[model samples]
Target: MRTSYFICGIYVLMDLASSDERSFRIYFDEFSIKYKVPDIFEKMDSTLVQLNNRSYINAEMILKRDVADLNVRAIMEFWKPKAQTNMKLYDVRVDGCNLLQSINKNKLFNFYVKSFKKHANVILKCPLKANFSYKMVDWFLDENDLPLFVPLGTFRTITEYFTQKRLAIRVLVHGKVLPKS
Candidate 1:
């Protein structure tokens, strides 16, 4: 058996060799999006759905204006059981176009690209045109992604999308890990 972990839109497999075989599995229960520039997006929709006994995140977004420069910043937070405060685990920003062009350079981003390659239809480079619709259907992370060790608990990842130097959209994904029996 294998377990997969997703953090900040990146999927990683928990394959640490240990004497104990028990491990936890992560699953998403909710997803939401916030538009800083409400009018800049022609359409934005994200929802968690169940299909054929499997969970998938369906999302679609259409831009109302063209974009020449693109950047992304992701912040991940982890919380203990019944904990009132959460701790920030990672926070980094990168050029979206460059990252997409050289997806293999960054191990984490490469996992994201691998997942997106199967489930998402969006721009891979710059010069995004207006009224172009992009979507991710039946998206779920599995063992074929990256490798990361995430303990049993809850986590939240907030990803912000930017056009030029201005903030455009924000994505909030919440999930938790439960012991597999």
Candidate 2:
């Protein structure tokens, strides 16, 4: 299992080795391909823009997955608010394979978030002690004590050899605010 984090996104790669069955590989990659920001101050600018009247901005994210050298197993678009807490997971997959269906009916994918005065922490709790956690971007607040822009964060989980072990790949992202006209 391998984990990588970048200013724009995160990527996780894993290789499953098996003695009887053929080897399987899985990957999870996500990045912010588009955004509008003028400069550093723009990220801190809490004012509502014409594109949206909300204090938070929407970033277009690219989610890609591959399994057993099969490209384009899944591609999706996900949007996240600048500020969030205690997100939930409704699905679990391994190399494009669904694991939630085989797991215990009572088990669930849990995600936790805690904010501090300076920075925030995101935690992904998986079954069988396969957990991932990371300290994310520092929160910027306005004079009114409201968030300006919470940085983007993402994580992925992959299971190797059926049940031999599980790997969790986590990433914390901070992107450059594009210049505004």
Best by TM-score: 1
Error of 1 at 159 (Å): 0.5
Candidate 2 least-lDDT 10 residues:
40-49
Clashes of each: 0, 3
> In angstroms, how far off is 85's CA in candidate 2?
1.3
| Candidate 2 error regions (>4 Å) | 1-79, 93-163, 166-181
Q: Give the Å error, residue 165, model 2.
A: 3.9
lDDT computed for candidate 1? 0.75
* Per-residue accuracy of model 2 over 123-178 as CA lDDT, tens digit each: 21223121222233423212122123333333332222222222222222222222
Query: Model 1: per-residue lDDT, tens digit, 27-55?
Result: 77778888888767899888898555445
lDDT of each: 0.75, 0.25
